[model samples]
Each structure stands twice: as structure tokens, then as C-alpha cells.
Target: MVSSKIIDRELFERILEKKNSLDKARPLSAEIVQKLRQEMEIEWTYNSNAIEGNSLSYEETRRVVERGLTIGGKSLREHFEAINHVNAIRFIEKLVEKKQKITEQTILEIHSLIVKGIDGVREKGQYRSGTVFIGGAVFTPPPPIELKARMLDLIDFVNKNPDKLHVIELAAISHHKLVWIHPFVDGNGRTARILMNLLLMKKGFPPTVILNVDRQKYYRRLKEADRGKSKPFVDFVARNVERNLDLYLKAIKTGKDEQYISLQEATRHCDYSQEYLSLQARNGKLEAHKLGRNWFTTKKAIQAYLKKHATKNQKLKFIQ
Candidate 1:
């Protein structure tokens, strides 16, 4: 069971607030939903593959999945990776639509779509038959002999939610544990991420993309979890969830001030300089997320931060 200390309550509540906002704005027009779904699918495919060292540029990935065109300088495997991932996303979406219960077979099917035409036929959806080690990962996976039991335990953990974990907590912990189990000889990272999103989507939350730019931080947090310091990893996952919720709200134009602005622009309402705000954003201190190379935060998020940190004697400076 994850300790209460593992997740930041403020961050967790912020995600719920934003998720509720998106929900309240629900039944979006088909055209808008379709457009947002398409944009997310491409971004999700690009980032998930990029984290695994796929060299396909975002546009190259878009072409491979959308146009089915072969990229000139990329390997067939890389192109296949892009295609396979989008297929995997669709598989999960269907499962969500049907409200399917996640089971061992369900996981296997997800992994199968991820590695199809890439891994050998026998290994495509199958657990490793021998021991394996993840490069640069702090912990070794359970041996092949323990794989089946470990996986069944994971499935039960997710289904039962014995600790009554929040959906996001359950998803993040399950993700870390799956990667820890190292169920497959390959594609475990991608599979874990997809499975995590499956859990999120099941709860009516949007699919969260862990950006490729945060790849190093992602691995570092996972390593921290392996070392029994789980908070950083869980918080890391929570931050991404909040970011996507913000994105969804922005796409739907849910509120007048819900849009994210560059940190430089955000400084107009607060005493912090752009550099300081960017630093806070990177540290997860301010409610901000990255757009490409720069950090973006909402005016509302800045006001919340100010209110939280201001002394009682100091009147809160509202962002008007």
C-alpha cells in the first residue's frame, strides 16, 4: 500500500478539480472531440516512442501513423513502432468504450499490439522465459519463474484497490510495479504507460502524456520509486495528469481564464521574474507545464500559489 506521504494532497486535489471542470463541460461536439482525440493520439504516440529512443521525428511519426508513408532515413522497426503504438492506443480506447475489466489477458493484448511485427512471434505478447535486466534501472526484475505470479498479483492489486487508492494513484503505482516486474523482454515501458492511461481513461480522465523532454526525469523518478522513495514518482505522474487536464480544459474553452500563458507573460501578475517562475515550474512548485521548450501556467494557478505562500499580514494581490 502507498503511504499518504507518497502523493501531494494539493496536487492530487488540483487534478480532481480540473477533471471535474472538464467533466462539467462534457458532451463536447463530435467534431471537437474528434479533433482533440486526433491531436492527443499523435502526441501520445510520438512521446511514448521517443522515450524508448525511437528516432522518428514528431512529423515523421505523424506521417507513419496517418499517411502510412515510409520515412526515408528511419529504420522499419522505428516506423513500425509508431504504427504499433497508435494501434495500441485505439485498442485501449475500445476497451474504455466497452468499460472492459482489465485482466491478465487484457494486458497481454495491449502488449501484443505494442510489439507486433517487431518482436519475434513467440515473444510478441509473452513474458520473458529467462531473467532480464533493465539498462540504467536501479532494480532487477523478478526472475522468469516469478513472472506469472507477479503479474497476477499486479492485476489483483489494480482490480481490488485494497487500499482504496484514487484512480490516478492506482494507475501510477501499477505502472511502476509493472515496469518493476519487467513482464516482457521488450516493450515493457510502452506497455506500462498505455496501461496507466487505460486506468485513467476508465475513470473518465484524459490520457496523460509524459513528455519526451521529461524522459530523464521520468527515469529518475522510477529509480527513486525502486529505492522506496515513491513520492517523487507518484508526484511526477500526478503533474502530468494535471497538465493533460489543463490541455483538455483549454481545448474545450471551459473557462475564461483557464488558458495557459508563457511564464514570461505570467510574470505580469506576480512579483516573481520569468526565470524564477520557470524554475518553480520545473521544480513542480508552481502549477505549470511545459509547452515544447518553455513553461506555461494559468493566471489562476499563479494566484493560487500567491495565496498559499503569502503572509496573513500581506494582502493577497489578485491577478486581475
Candidate 2:
């Protein structure tokens, strides 16, 4: 729904720069890629399900998905949601490896994997047969009778104009439009997210996971999209993708010792208090950024800042 003219050109260029840097670091060792993929499987599942109101914590989701352990006090549906989302991620990986095209059947297959054992067994891969309403949403989906044709049109539009927009924009718009269609009775949010990642992976970018912590902003952006102004939502998705690119690039470009750690953790290697380091980061004295209200900087960045400061202090002492 975002028109090209409305896109923030500066932000778009910044994401492309990050993405291009990622591509230059290509052919990451298979082992590293596999490890990152495994970690992402659990994290992506947890965040995606959490956004949809699933109560499983990050640790619980990891246990359920990895160990097949039944968590105490958690509903069977919650467990299924966790397991189904990982399975869906695996399915998407296979599709990416095969370089599959995006189509209605492909979308349904992904949805089927997502809702396999959940309450909507009968409607797992099927569109809605009746009206449905999104709670707290300002816009309503099209009537059930019009759903199929509209979905086909969406697919047709995507396939026809694959090169008309930036890849990130393409993925974000696909995500917004799918949510607008609201084809299925349930799992629409999760499925749209998976579809968005599918588009990203197809374009040779890493699959992005929108943190559950950003759910409020996420929904707010979607609501903005409903009002026929989609730049906000598109920018939201682009920021997520940028964050993901930063993560991947940091992992591959740096050695095992150069981790992107919290400021508090960075203090273990230095004599600065957490407050001081955070203040430095806030004032741009350190190369760091806030992720979810916490400042994160690499040891390399901190070391660089400290070395520069030490040199400056020595010069001042000599002058005295």
C-alpha cells in the first residue's frame, strides 16, 4: 500500500547499504550459518507466537521446540503453537533452498504447516467461509465471498511487478496486503509474517524476526496502513530487516571475541560503570545503539573509544 514517492529515501538507502555489506560477506561457513539458523528457529518461533498472544516464554518455547518437553501450566494449544511455528520455519527454509516461487498454493502450504495441530484443523489451509473481525482494528477485511478473488489479485500483482519495487518494500507490502485480506479464520498474523520472511529469503536476504517487544508499534503501524498511509508500516518492517542485517553482519564479520553485548556486559572488560557507558553511548561517544531500551556495543567499539580517549588524555597531561 506504500507508494514509492512516500517512502523515506534515506532509510531505504541505509537498509540497502547494510544489505549490500551483508552480501559482500557472502558464503558464510556452513557451520556458522547452520548455528545461526538453529538459534533463529527458536527465537523466531517465540517472538512470532508471542506477538499473537501466546503465553509461552522464550525459554519455554525453546524447550518445547527443541526437547519436546511439556511445560508445566501451559496449555496444549500453546505448546502446539510453538512446535507448529518451528515446523513452519523449517518448511520455509526448504522452500528457500529450492528457490520456490510465491503462489497461492505455496502460501496455503506454509499456513498448513503453521496451524497443523491448532484449533483450526478443518480450516488450516482453507480461507474463511464467514465474516471475521479483528479486535481493536480500525479496518475490516473484505467479505468472505470476495476473499478468493482479492487474494488471487494480490498474488497476480506481486508476481507481475517483482522488479518494480525494492525487495524490502515488496516484502513489507506483501505482508500488509495479506493482513488486509485476512483470508483465514485464524493464524493470519503468523502466516503473514512467515510469508514476509519467505519473500525476504527468496531475495537472498536473511529471514527477519519482528521482536515481540515491538508488538504495540507493529500494530500501530498496521493500523496506519489501514488508513491508506503505509509508509509507517513499511518503515517499521525496514527497520526490523536492518536490525537483522546488523546481527548477521556482526556475527560473520567479527571474530568470536567481538560479540554485540549489552553495555552492562561490556563493563566486565573495562572499568566503566553501566551508567557511564550508557551515558557515553547516548552521547555518541561510543559506537552503540539501543535495542529495546538497552544499549548494546561491541568490545571493539568500546576499546576504540577508550584508546582514543586515552590518547587525548595523554596529550592534555603532556601539555600541562
Candidate 3:
């Protein structure tokens, strides 16, 4: 076993301290950052019943994301099922469209959904319905009398913490402590992951989804964290952050300055574009870049450049 000394918890804390700083990132990492976002969406958009290998292709997955963006309107479980569709187009659409609020009740609602479809989920939202064992030890939840208070204390801690801790650390601890408290009867694992991302997204880090491909490693890291080993889990999370950063960067970099398609530019490049890429970029993406003018990319860039220089009376004809 690698010695605990090799992975100092403080190292992780230092990283967390740094990441929480705004503008800590550079434009050079656009590609990687976008991929991370895509991967995270893929990971969270899973069905409890489906074989782990099942997934939507890139195009089909975006729609599911669109659904996730609007997930706030419905019951927790219904929203989860809607987002977990095996379609990339749907997933990305949801992700790009909406942002959900985080709160104690939101956590509970999600907890309810994660356990709802699982086998032996009869206990559903209640505290432990099935036997649980940890480290060859019989497991017992906090006394029923204490369960609600413990949960309340946790939510209070999350909301009232001083010094502005990194949301990821807050999230990791939420996973650890929630399991320790084992507040609900079921859905602990799934709910924990969802809450982790809720915290992540709340912190502007985007979602950090643990892919089925990384499930074994993820579990092992969690085990280490539970055993009073914090840095390994931090490393696991940092790696994910790094991965997500890669994804975001990718989405931003692929197009040349000219290809910077706005939502309005959609119709010209793709077969079905509800959104378009326009020269006058109005989204946060361009504002974040501190550019002189809103513009699309590559081919679209040329059109905008031409339109800007066009004679007032001349109508511009361009390729679709």
C-alpha cells in the first residue's frame, strides 16, 4: 500500500484553496474543460436499471442535458429519470439550458430518487431498509431519534461554514458524512454523487461525474477517504476537475475565432439547429472572453466580417 505520507491531506486542501479562487483558470485549457463537462454529463445521466455499458452517442446525448437544465420543475425522481435518457443531444441540451438551485430539501429530494428505482428500495425515503455492513463490521445508523437532527446539523454546516471552503471539499465531506450518518434508508451512493455535483456546479466547477468506467476506482477512493484517508479522494476529485476543465476548453477551442458560433448560427452549420451562431454574440461565453465585438467562428466569422464591412445598401448573400 502506498504510505499515507505520500498523499498529504494538506496537499489536497491547498489545491482546493487554489481552485476556489475565481479567474484561476487560463484560456489555454478550453478543449479539456469542455470534454470534462461532456464526460460528467455522460456519467450522471445513467439509469440504475440499465447495463453499465449502455450510452448515447454524442449527438443524441445533448438532449438529455437540455432536460437536466429544466429539471427543477418536477418531482425529484421524475427529473432524474428524464435526464438519464440514453441520448446525447437531449442531455447536452438540458445541461446548456438550465441551472438548478441547491438546498437541503434539494438534497433530500434527490436522495429519494436515487433509491426509488433500486432493488429492495421498499424503504425508499426512510432511513435504512436493508442490512448494511462496513469493513466487515455490522452497520448501524444513528439512532432514529438523532437522524433528523444529524441531517439538519449537516445542512446547517454546509450552509453556514466560514472561510468559504471549496465546494468540492464540502461535497466530498457531504458524501463521507452522509454515509456515516446514513440519513436515509437507501439511495446513498447515487444521491451522494448527485449532491457532489450539485455542490460542484454551485461552485462554478461544472459537474464532476464518475463514469461507470471509473466506478471501481471511484469506490476505492471513497473507501480510502472513509478510512481517514483524505488526499486520495481529493486526488480523485482533482483529476476529475482537471478532466472537466479539459472538456470546457475543447468546446471553446475547436472553432477558429471565426467559428465562434452564437446560438443564432445554428441553422447554417447543422441540419437541425434550434440555436444559431451570430456575429453579435450575446451569451456569457463571449462576455467571459472580454472580446471587442460579439462574433461567430470560422465560416460564420467570415460572414460577420463581411457584413460588418458591407455597404449599407448591399444585401449580403452567403452559404447556408
Could you say which candidate leads in TM-score?
2
| lDDT per residue as tens, model 1, 183-272 | 898899999999999999999999999999999999999998899887788899999999888777875664546556668888887877
Q: Which ten residues in a row have the lowest lDDT in candidate 2?
A: 311-320
Give a tens-digit lDDT track for model 2, residues 103-215: 89988888888888777457988898888898878978999999889989888866776548777777888899999999998889999999899889988788899999999
Off by over 4 Å in 2: 1-6, 254-320
- Whole-model Cα lDDT of every candidate shown, in order: 0.85, 0.82, 0.51
Error of 2 at 49 (Å): 0.2
Over 1-320, each residue of candidate 3 has an lDDT whose tens digit, in order, gives 11223334665445444443323544435544454444545545653212233344332334445434433333444444435332322322343357644456666666555454545557655665344554422345576678778887877766765434555666777766676676666556656666666566665665665666676676677677767776677667666765655444434554454323433453453332323234233443222221112223445444553466445443244545
TM-score of every model?
A: 0.79, 0.79, 0.54
lDDT of 2 at 87: 86
**Top-lDDT candidate index:** 1
Clashes of 3: 65
Off by over 4 Å in 3: 1-40, 47-103, 116-119, 129-131, 134-143, 162-164, 254-320
